[model samples]
Structure formats: C-alpha cells, structure tokens
Target chain A: MAIHHLESVFFREKVAEALEDQTLRGALQNATGLFRQRRLAATASLSDWEKLRDQARAIKAETLTHLDHYLPEFVAKAESNGIKVHWARDHQEACQVISQLVSEKQARRIVKSKSMTTEEIGLNHVLETDGAEPIETDLGEWIIQLAGETPSHIIVPAIHKTKAQIADLFVDQLSIEPTQDAEELTKAARRILRHHFAQADMGISGVNFAIAETGSILILENEGNARMSTSLPKVHLAVMGLEKILPRLADLEVFLRLLPRSGTGQHLTSYQSILSGPKRNPDQEGPEELHLLILDNGRSAILAEEITRQSLACIRCGACLNACPVYQQIGGHAYGSVYPGPIGAIITPQLAGLSETKNLPYASSLCGACRDVCPVKIDIPEILLHLRAKSVEAHENGKEAKGFRMWAWINRSRFRFVWAHRLARLGGRIFMKNGQPPQWLQRRAPVLGAWAKHRQVPTLAKRSFREIWKKELSRKQP
Target chain B: MTRNEEAKEAILQRVGQALNGGGVRAPRKHPITDQHYAGRPQTDLDLVSSFQEKLESVGGKVIRAQNLEQAFNELWSICQERGIRNLACSDAPSFRDLTDQAPEGLEILDFPHEQAELLEAEAGLSEAQLGIAETGTLVLDGEQENHRLTSLVPPVHIAFLSSKNIVLHLGEALSRAQQARSFPRTLTFITGPSRTADIELTLVVGVHGPRELVVFLLP
Candidate 1:
C-alpha cells in the first residue's frame, strides 16, 4: 500500500507525473465532464438558483460571524438529546477523543462512511495504530483503502480508477474471481462488506450540515453504506468541522436543494439522514450512544481574516474541482494533499500553512471557472490571489519576490517598458528553440522556466505594440 | 477543568476571539425570505403520479394500491417476485394489518430487540411519515413505530405510504418536521434504492442498504 501523505513539496513533479498518465487523465475528464453537465441540467430546473446561492452564502456568513453563539447552542441541544459532544483543538486531540471513545466501548472492529473530515484527521490510521480495525464502508472508500490510497475526489473517491483496475483490486483483495463487469465487482465487494457490517462494533461518519435549530446532523449519500454504518453499529461517531453548522433547520431547505444538484446532478441522494441523537426508545434500532466531535484544526485562523474566511463556507460538493481546467489536466493527486482542487489549493495552505503548500496557490491559471460554478459563489480566484500575496509576503525579498517587484517597477514607465520588451525579444532569440524556451534555461532561470516547461511561453512580437501604434498615428496625420 | 472540558473551552474561546466574540458585533437580521419553489409546483394529481415517476426513475418500484385488497395483493406478488420467504415488519398499523394476511410458508419475524431477526429476513416493511413529491423522497421518523433497521439491514425494503401523506416540496416537509417540540432522534429522507457509481462512474445498484425499495401507496 502506498503511503498516502501530502506531496506538496513536490507539487510540480507530481503534476508532471499526472500529466503523463493518459489513463488518469481520461478517467478524470470523463467523470468531471459528466458532473459538470449534470449540474447544469439539474440546476436548470430552478429559476432562482442565483437567489438560492445568495441565501446560502448569507446564511453561512451570518452563522460564521456568530459561531461562538451557535456552537454552544448546538452543543446544548445535542447534549440534551443524549448525544455526547466533544471539541478538538487540533488533529491529535480529535484522534484522541475518538480513540478514547472506541476503547471505552472495547470495540475491535470499526466501520466508517465517506468523510472528508476523517480524511483530514487521518482517523483510520490512528484507529488502526490503536489496535482497532476500521473498515471503510463506502464502496469508493473501500476500493481506495484496499489499494492503500486516499480519496482522489471528494464525492467520488475512486473516480480515477478504471473498471478493469477495480476488478483486479477486488480479485486480489477479496479473493473474488476476476471479472470485467462492474456489477459483479460491486456485488463481490458487497458480499464481503456485509459480513463486516454485521460484525462491526462502531461506525464513524462525516456531517454535511449540523443544524443548530434542531441540533441535528445531516448526511447525504447515494450508497446505503452510511445508513448501514449508522444503523447497524452500536456506537456511532460523527466527526465534523465546526464550520459545518447552520443557524436553523429552515436553512437546510436551500442547501439541500443546492447540494445534490451541484454534487452529482441528482434531484436528491438515495439517503438523507438527519440524526439528532442516539435512540430515545428502548425498542427503536439506532446506536445506543452518539458522539459528535467538533474539530477546529486551524479553521479559526482562516475565519479571523475577512477575505479568506469565505473559503470556509464550502459544502464539499466538489463543483469547483469539476469546473477547474487545471484540475481536468492534472487531477487531484497532483495537489499532493487530502484536498486536491481549487478548494484544496486555498484551504490546504491555510490549514497546513503557506511555507510547505505555497506552490499550491500558484497551481491555477486564475481563469475564474471555479468561482463562476461555485454554488455558494466563493470567489476562489480572489482567494487564490490573496494566498499568492500571503505566500509572497511570507517570503519577502526572496528571489521571485524581488523579480516581481523589479518587473513591476520597469513596467511603470513607457521607456523602461519598451526597453524591457526589446531586451526580452533579444533574450527570446538567444534562449529559443522552435519558438519555445529550452528546458535547460527553464531549469536555470526557475520562474518563467518552470512555467514554460508545462505551457508555451508567448513569443515577443518583432515591434512593440506601443511603437507600432505611435508610427501609425504619425503616418495618418501626415 | 477536565481535559475534555478544557479542550472545549479553548476551542470556543478561539472561535470567540476570531469572530470578535460576544457583544462586539450585533447579530444581523437574516430572514428566511425566499419562499419561492425552485422547481415548478405540481398539482394534487401530479403530486402522486410525479412522485411515482420520480421514485421509479431513481430505481425504486412504486405499487399504487387503490384499496386494502389491492395493497395485500401487491405485497403477496412482491414476496413471490423477489422469492422472499422470511419477512419482518414494523409495528405501524398498515404493516400490522398486512402481517395478519401474510402468505402461508412466508415466515413473519418480529422486530427483535437483539436485532438478529432483522438481519435474517429477506425483506422488511415500514410505514412512511410522508412523501415529498419534488424529490420523490420518503420521510421516516424513527421515533415512531418505525425501527431504523426495518428499512436498512434487509436486502429489500417495502414501505407503505398513504396518498394523503405526499407533499409538494421540501419546505412543507421541513414545516412538518418542525411541528414537534423537539426533533426525532432519526429522521431519514430516502429517495431510491441504495446505489453507487464510484467505480469509473459506473452506476451500480444495491451497494450496502436495501438493493430494492418497493413502495405500496395506499389510496
């Protein structure tokens, strides 16, 4: 099993590798293209999608502004309903709370649903290290876990794996006969997982929305694994980012409308579970104990800033990922983080800090497709620009920073701008081969060189546009 | 403070400081003003037919029973079609009446407290609180006679929904959900049979939950 850890340090090399894998590119293009089309069609039924987006954005913004108030309200309501709410300041603490809960139950086998929060905290690894076997119940999650890889997409984890490859994985792991049929592969997985579901002692899941009004956690899933995880297991733990809370149950109407459409282009997911607490009646079948972990892993830091705080409003629909051209080319693994798209680019650096993930912000072309398709209208490009500035400030007076400043100074005056253009053309000739800079120059120069390696560097015109305009004006006057 | 309490306090304090805490910013008045339905509002007749169409489109079977005899016939046929020999049912009145008339040789299991009976049954039955027409959703309130496993653990789930329980949209459902002083412990909105497309975006039905969901709508 490949160790699934952030390769942010080798972001460029990772992207280069992903670019060469035709299979990965084909799978991503096919999956993301379908998602983009479905979202358009699904949303076209609604005449007031923009208004709904505005309402969603406002509700999230207002709740975040009063998070201190809503968090306690949610805790109080949830606790009153027989749910034990735990707060974790960081990833380690979050893992400890869960580990304690698991040990307290003396649970040996654990089942988990698809949760980006669990992925962020590396929850499965922590549980396994503590002597509990955590089985991923979601089919996508199960396939990736079998292959010892993390999720490649937020909603569809194994989107990059071909059916043939999946069939092979099933044959190797579950000892099922190798078959090219997707349904057979799925049934083989189901046959094996159902046994674990019956024997599993605990289940862990992620919350899509935590409603403060009712103190309920909403989870949406197309597969019934999440339902099984919560239904069958005696102990269920819901790990949620503290920012997931909404002010009211009424707010869910808009989000519920937006989430399924933006995510998979479905009118609704197969199951939308709204759980408030553990079983109230002795006869009712649900977990005896419900534990809610509210995680604050550097999210408060992002919420402190006005511009970057809106990034916290993400619902994890993965719309931005599908809309991004750069993502279509490189795929999620290239971002080298648990999150691998535009949202990942902004939030990963914020959560992990800019020093290690600085290259992630520059991964985009700032084409604004992500922002345009964003259900909540999170100005993703604006956030990318903000992160770029932060990355620059962190490395103030560094070589690249100095070059940018120098370029900015020269472009401020007409003469320097024209002279710089002339020099650039001369440099172009000296470094050019077939109208593109050589890889060696890119290696030595490092800034433009790095970009030119992946993309074509624009050739300088023989005469400056400014000079040509001036000559034409003079000739017309004569 | 204990370790857990201390952690909770620290997180809340950080959130307070980040959002400028307590009386610093006045609470904004954000009203829930957009009452407009996103999709076209369906007429009363369209609600039933559209609900059936939408549910069927998502891989769920709808058996519209005009009366008690028709409903019983539908259940018998479902058992025969799926080769369901052992079945479990909720204590809902509709299901209880059907259990009395359940076919011979069809073993009827009770909702066991140990929950082992639910696992062995080929099919389980429950009565839905209501149905949402817009999304073709079944709203089940678990605090009632319905057990979560009755619809979940079995390979097949049969739900008995009444025609009058069908609503136009999610807003109506939310209002209905909010009617109680406190929310139910488990409130589920099930749209169709469990499915997945995780493997190369290939749609595969019956992943973990009920592979087949049959709804017998009572007139």
Candidate 2:
C-alpha cells in the first residue's frame, strides 16, 4: 500500500492555512525555542560533540552501504535469539503481516508505543478496520489519537496544541473533568492507559537501533509506556525501517551519546530498553513471543541514489525541525507528512515520489540549520536542492519549468534582456499604484496574485539604472 | 520459497543492486576506537558525587548507605514515610532476602506472582547491575533479575546500587555488558523517573512509569 500523506499535494494552501492559526504559531515558537536552547546546552556539555557526530555519520555510512551483508546476519542472529523476523517489501505488506499476526494470536486489545514506521504504514487504521483496537500509549500520541489528528512534531507530537485545547479535548474524548493542569491531564492518561495495558494481549513499538551482531533492538522513551507495551502483553511486535541497523553492538555507544543530546537536549532519556529477544525462561516477565518487522517501504529506492541515501541516517531527533525557520512558521502539519521539516522536505519527495510531494523540497529556505544540528550530519539542504532539480526535471512541461526557460531565454542576450526589462517597467507604470500592484492586475495574473497576496511588490524604478547612471551619476562623479 | 523468504530475497536484491550501482559512492572506514568522554569522572569519589548530582538533577533521590543493612533500613523508612504496605521486589539475590526481613506491616512480595498482583503493589524494588555516573543511569540486566516489571509497573520504584558498581560513563557500562558471555535478554538503562513535557511543553513527571525513583547506594 502506498504511504498515506495528510496533505502534501496542496502544500501552499496548507501553509497558508497554518499561518492563519495564531495559537498554533505561538505554541510552535515556544516549543521550538525551548528545544533549541536545551539541545544547545546538552550538546555543549560534551567536549567531543563534534567528533561524535563525525563518528556517527561514518558508522551510518558504512552500515547503509553494506546493508545487504548485515540484513541476513541480523536475521540469523535474531532468529537464534528467539525472535521471529519478518520482511516486507512495502507498507501494504508490512501492515498485512501485522494484521495477520493480530488475527493469529486472536489479540483484540493491542497497545502501541509511539513508532513512526507504523505511522508511515498507517497501521492503526488497518488494525481498526480489521476489528482490532490499537491504543497509542505515548502521552502525545494518545492525545493526537483522541483528537483524530496526526502529530504536529516528531519529538513533541502535540506541540501545536495549547493546554486549553488539550483540556477541552480530554473532556470531549476521555470524558474527564476539564482542567488545564498538565499534571492532572497526564495523570488521567496514565490511569486510562494503564487499564488498557492490563487488558492488552499484544503490544507494538518502534526500534531506535537494531544491532546485527547481538541481534538486539534498543528502544528509547521518556514515558514507561514502551516498557509496559512490550512487557505486559503476551506478544510484542517491533516495527522498523530497514535502515535502522548497526553492524556491531558496540557502535551503539556513539549513537546513544548523540541521539538524546541532539533530539531532546538531554544527556540521556529516562529509559533505554535493549532487548535481544523474547523471555528466555517461563519465570521471566516479558513477551512470550517477539516479532520484528523490517520494512523497505521505498527506502531501497531512496538508497538507490547517492545524493538521497544520506536521509536514511536520520535518527528522527527533531533537532532539525526545531532549528528550521520554515518548520517554525508552518509547524509539522503544513508539510502533510509523517516526517517534516528540512529532513522531511528531502525524504518525502524521494520516498513518496517527486510527483506527489514535489512542493516539500521547496518548503525550506535552504538556511542549513538542519544540517548544523543533524546528529548524523545529513546534508539536508544539498539534498533539498537535488530533489528540487529532480522535481523540475520530472515536470519539464509545467509552468515553473516554462517560466525558467523563458527567463534563461531573455537573459541570453543583452538586447532581449533590455527589451524584456523595458516591457516589464512599462507594465509596472500602468498597473502599479504607489509601489503596489493594482488589484485588477493581480486578478489578471493569478501567479502574481498568489505571490502578492502576502507580500508588497515594489514598483519598478521610474527610470532604468543604466539611464540614471548615465544622466545623473556621470555628471556628479569625476 | 515462502512468501516471507521471497520478500527477504527481493529486499536483499534491491539493496545489492543499489549499492553495486554507480549511484552510491564507496563507503569510508570508521575509526575502530571512539574518543572517550573527557569530562567523565576520573576517581571513585568523583564518580559517586557525580552520580548523585546527575541523578538528583533529573529528580531521582539518592541515599548513601554505609552498608547493605543501612540501605535496607533506609528502604524501610521510605516505605513507612510513604505509607507503602505492599512492596513488590525482584527475585534477584540482593532483594530476595527482603521478604524475610520486612518491617512488621510492610509486605515484601517477591516476583513469580501474577501480573495483576504486581500492578496492585504500591511500590517496586530492584537491584542495579551497574550505575553510570556520567548520566546518573542505572543498568539492569534481566538475566540476573527475573522480574522486569518490578521496577516499571508500580508508581514508586526503589533501587539498590553498590557504590563499586558505579561506572564513569555509558561506554564503560556498555563495554562491560559486551564482555559478558552472551547479551542479556533485556538490558535497561534508566536515568530518572518517567517524565513528559508533551502537553503544551509543560513538564509533567511520572506519566506511565514510576513517578518517583529512590536509589540507596551501598558501600
């Protein structure tokens, strides 16, 4: 099944709509500012922060290049460790495998920890359609699930919501007393989710890092929901993109040091659960069966390109999202992708296809803040430019391509350039009023109308620069 | 071949084709040894003090005890102060003896119980295999302790750590685990109690995990 996007097609319309929301913009500014400050402080504490980034990037490069050699090795080791490894070629097959597991186990109540891979595959929708209930246990995921919306940010999923809005949402969906106290709200979620944990027969989570040598998967979370979901249930299912692999267990040290600091500005998250496999003994308290689903889901296609493959190194830290100016203005929803911000701008076009998510690459101003804060040192802006060129190439007959061609044509010769400039100035003289384009002119030219909707269009100079230089500057100068 | 095997083969083929294609550049060799943290505590005293400060920074309470007996006494007092009647504990050797020496009213329920009973316990107790001073983290090995839920399901968790087991950094702790005969089924590194700031960026402590973590360091 193709990955479902909330709104990548009409990117400009979504961005405009997002710009109109005052509360969302305020929430985003506060959250992003706080994350940026914390990340800075956290990274500064480490003297080897720069060295760690280089090491992490190198490790990811090596592993991704030789992934075929590691995949089977991981599968062999994980299976020997009592984990049943499943492979899926796409999102549809991944969801189908999970649905089959749910039915096979006769699991009705399924608890889920936050996993972006599952979100990309639309797993909850599939499970709900199959008559199985999948409850999101992470505090932010649960809130968005209740709101019938998607995450606005990767790290803080509900960063777009105000406390008042959350309280109202809680009152409406959870039927709790309406209170804006974050503590009380969190308590209510814990109380309810705990009940679900007690009843759940199956649990699902995402993998942060999968070690090939040890056949172990590491899950990092602040809330204990991940632990509960993986432990309380009889069966545990972990979903991951195939790129989330490391060749050796020892390599985790570099990533472990980098991820928390870059993502949340913490030395380490509250909990890091490293599980090699299911319970070794019946007396132990853990899942009886552990299933690991490794999904390609367009990542292989992304890896096929040298320029785009660096995107797979992302740890989903959200530091780039916090640093991105475009993400700050539009928030995550405007991009209409599970992955957003600068990283999303590059990855979405490649994974979802340039035709469907062409506007995503243009979402950034290419300021390179994402690259600066990226733990894996992914050159996000470079990839963004690459994807933009690909988009233009794919749509060669489109108006944007035609406009570029016209621009190049006019600029090829001084005579044509001067004539075009004079023609534009004449039009400006007729249609511009006090340095603003006339409403009629805006209406006549839809592209100009869209461009001028949120901006001031300066009127062309009364006389050409060359004319002014010849007539005034020449007389004044020596 | 089964469908799953065929899928694996197809994925490997794609990966091989992608790598062998001229599109990808040759992979660079990573350094075998990473630079150790320069700021990590160098001495035992520094490690102890740093561990205490780091753990305390994240809202975990640390109590220094002269010995295991003193640590048990501290645990008893904490339970009494909090009005904890039922305390669940792991079957690990360090906590196994607590059931016999529990104070009059405090009932120490060891693991091997039903999951429902564990959920009802007011507090949980477990022993750490190692403590990381740099991040104030506790490393727990599930192979050594049978009850993984003992430290997770309850609202309050009390952990006992030996001062000698404290390491200077995460790399040291991980290296020690790597040197083991085989990796444990589950190894957890916990820095503090469960927390979240997701709702309007408001920091809320104790979401789904224990709200309070109390560690008694034994000499």
Top model by DockQ, which number?
2
lDDT of 1 by residue, A397-429 (tens): 898888889989999998898888899999988
- Per-candidate iRMS values, in order, are 2.0, 1.8
Per-candidate DockQ vs. reference: 0.67, 0.71
Candidate-wise lDDT, in order: 0.86, 0.88
Tens digit of per-residue lDDT, candidate 2, span B146-195: 64788898899889899999998887898899888888999999999999
Summing lDDT over every window of 10 consecutive residues in candidate 1 chain A, give the lowest-scoring window. A1-10
> Candidate 1's error at B68, in angstroms?
2.8
Instruction: Give the runs in model 1 whose Cα sits over 4 Å from its true position.
Output: A1-4, A408-433, A436-448, A455-477, B21-26, B33-45, B97-100
* Tens digit per residue, CA lDDT, model 2, A1-478: 2566546998898998999999889988999999999999998887777878888888888888778777777889999999999999999899889999999999999999999999899999999999999999999999999999999788889899889989999999889997989999999999999999999999999999999899999999999999999999999999999999888877878888889988888889999999999987788879999999999988988777777778999999999999999999999999988888888888777777877798898898888999999999999999999988888888889987888899999999999998988999998888788777888888998888888987889777778889899999989986
Q: Which tens-of-lDDT digit does each residue in B115-216 have in candidate 1?
A: 666777898888898898888899998767665788887889999888899998887888898897666888999999889998888888888888899999
CAPRI tier for the interface of model 1 = medium
Which residue pairs overlap in candidate 1's backbone?
A442-A449
